[model samples]
Target chain A: MNYTLHEQEFTQQVADLIQQTACILPEDIERALVSARALEASDNVAYSVLDTILKNVDVARKQQQPLCQDTGLPVFYVHYPCGISTRIITRCIQDAVVQATADGFLRPNAVNPLTNKNSGNNLGIMIPCFHFMEWDKPEIQVACMLKGGGSENMSIQYSLPDAKLSAGRDLNGVAVCVIDAVIKAQGNGCAPGIIGVGIGGDRVTGMQSAKKQLFRLLEDENEYPELDKLEKSLLAQLNKLEIGPMGLGGKTTVLGVKIGMVHRIPASYFVSVAYMCWACRREVMSYKL
Target chain B: MNKKIEMKTKHIQLPMNKINTRKLKLGDKVLISGIIVTSRDMAHRWMMEEKSDIIRPYLKDGAIYHCGPIMVRDGEKWICRAAGPTTSIREERYQSNIIQEYGIRCVIGKGGMGKRTAQALRTFSAVYLSAVGGAAVIYANSVQSVKAVYQLDAFGVPEAMWVLQVKDFPAIVTMDANGNSLHEDIEKKSIQNANQNQ
Candidate 1:
């Protein structure tokens, strides 16, 4: 059996990825919006915003246009198979971004933070970082999301003494802290959004887990029932705050709360929260050929 | 069901072709039918640094969308790439000054503006319109024409201002001329509710 990697194949894959982003709103995001609409309290400003958001999704899908204009900084999660060259894959991604930008599928959002210079090709320093995990399978899977800065600004982390602390911890305390962080966000993260919570792990691990957890399908079952229940409860509590859509006052402030947990050292339980805006642009692709 | 109460307020009709910032109101649901220019951080910085009157021609009764659009060129024509509302917070430092200096009346973006901008809105009779944050493509459809482009040749498209002709552009009245802000209202209410629950 022979597996071949070609530049053309790479380019096509990238183009396909970009084009797919144009048409398909990610399944998780679609589910989130539907759930928001269903859970949304009727006849309020939030409901009106949701209605407009739903309409936007419909229009975006039909026109094959990007859901939100801030198409955000392109973040790629690449799972490389054993024996794959990381450098080649990196170059492929960079080339793909340039092609995608040239094709008008992506906005060149990469810029030098200090110099305020635009990276014309959408390729910048340390961008498209590859997190390698060895899988037994020969195939590679790449997941990409245009994580807009609006929502990215809302990510939070807390290091706790133990995993049991959160469970045993004051629900009210937890709620207050979360609400405080969100309110302080001050409509910056684009409300009527989803929150991804990762509990238990080291600081970096917890943060990464929280972000990766965002890729999970909205309808998918959590492996841990306790976590799932907590997520549902948090979702309800968050919406009850009536932060509404765009924080203008409505019942559906949070679309859902997804909690991902892992075993932590008995001494420490780290928690992180990642917020994703209504655009929630993420795509998963398994490459062949 | 909550009562479906509709109250009619004074409606100001500005020709879709042109809009002056001085002619807007608080809580006015405007159907802007005209050409507007878009600029974000890069463009703002450029304008401030250059202090040139490059933006003046585009500002005469024309709206300025606080956006950095994704665009692609087809031969001579530019196609709208993903164009969405950027957070207006970053522009708070520059927006009020830009409005006063450029004679800009209507500014379109998302999230909220700060105290300075709210004051500018009140004093200048300019209005801040909130477009849905992530709905880039839907907002782009309101753009019926791409009239011109500025700067950002080497920096790619996001830094450039693409003058656009828009029709019935939908935006919520966020900051009004009377020193009212929906964002501030929401924040206060949210904190109040949070405190009450506590």
Candidate 2:
């Protein structure tokens, strides 16, 4: 199966996707937030704070405004056909970012890590990062996540069975490590956050899997029953910790939890916890040529 | 303990002094209406080193906010796009000195400061206001106008200091001048919660 697409139209579509993601909360996230708001204790101030956020979400979508100022670096995961030219896709995405930034759909956020200078259009060396995968599907798949800087700071990786945590090298230990990370966040990751857990991988792969889990919808269940149960239990336990919205103490500390697993070497168990603020700015696009 | 009693929010006004700050307690709700300066990591460090005259006059009665906002330029004027609070824990190293030097009465940001910052707030008669993080669009709407922007070339837009006049800016009292810190209490309580859950 093959489809033809115009280069310029494709670029515009990618830009539209980026801008659309920046301006609106994805449906799953919106529903989760609404439900979380409903579940919060009436006395909890986090409920009111979350109300402000919910209203802001409405305004952002109505006014076509970026939900959060951070409008973090645009990270892309592309699923392109084997015969497609990734070079063209990369260039188109880069140009789209610049256009989006100029249009104020994105903040000029990509800065020179060394010089501390902003590119003014969100394009920098290896910025607006792209991860390409060759897929059999003919339609190009594009997904983006506007991960905030504050929550990104909360992302942590741990080597399991640590004596400090009494964590053993098992799934139970992974649960412990992930929960510990959440407790450490103390609402700093912009609570009522979505926790993405990566288990059973080496350090780099562990972090990657953690991030990839963020693309999964909050309403979706993991195919593996064990991992699915882990996500559910973790979500319940974290909320019980009363880390509530902004850590103000309530029943809805986490909107959801997602876990991804990969085979690891016998010597080590690595876990990466990626905390996403409730905004969860993710959108997907497919252009059938 | 009644979480209901804890949930009752008490609003507060800005331009607070030692006495006014003392009246604030942890977990009290506050809605601040006043002028505040936006400054982040690099701006705080720059203030210590360069002693920028631009920020001095504003410091007399103004609070400082920890934020890196999204701003849109319309001709020569600027509009606040999404001016939400950034995490405040990152400024623990410099917050104490900045609070004292600037004669700042309030420090608005998300998350909260540590023991050292709590001590500074106690000594300086200042309070820490925890704004709702990730509610940038809401915050931007609170801004009345952008008075001025400086150091764009040196610190870049997000890191640069912008003098903003705001009205009814919402926040919670997380750090009171009397040395009570809600964030500290939360961390301790959360750890206990984790232990019990395990």
Best by TM-score: 2
Off by over 4 Å in 2: A1-4, B1-14
Weakest lDDT window of 10 consecutive positions for candidate 2 chain A = A40-49
**Cα lDDT tens digits for candidate 2, A1-289:** 4456688999999999998999999988888888888886655577777787899999989988889888887999999887778888999999999899888888888778798887788888888899999888778999999999989999999887788988888788988888888888987889889999888788888988999999999989999999999899988898888878888777788899999998899897898899898879999999876
Chain A accuracy as TM-score for every candidate:
0.87, 0.96
Model 1, span A1-289: residue lDDT tens:
3456676787578667866765467766777777677765554555656777888888878877777766667777777666777777778887887787766667777778887777777788876555766576667677887777789987887654235333333334345445655676656788877778777778878778888877877767678887777777777767767777776667678766777766667776666788877677778777763
Q: Give residue A8's lDDT in candidate 2 (0 to 100).
A: 96
Model 2, DockQ value?
A: 0.56
- For each candidate, the alpha-carbon lDDT, in order, equals 0.71, 0.86
In candidate 1, stretches whose alpha carbon ends up further than 4 angstroms from where it belongs are: A1-3, A38-44, A159-175, A262-269, B1-27
lDDT of 2 by residue, B39-123 (tens): 9988888888876777888876568999998888999999988888999988889888888887888899988888898899888
Pairs of residues at least 3 apart in sequence or in different chains that clash in candidate 2: B10-B29
Q: Estimate each model's TM-score.
A: 0.88, 0.95
Q: What is the lDDT of candidate 2?
A: 0.86
Error of 1 at A151 (Å): 1.1
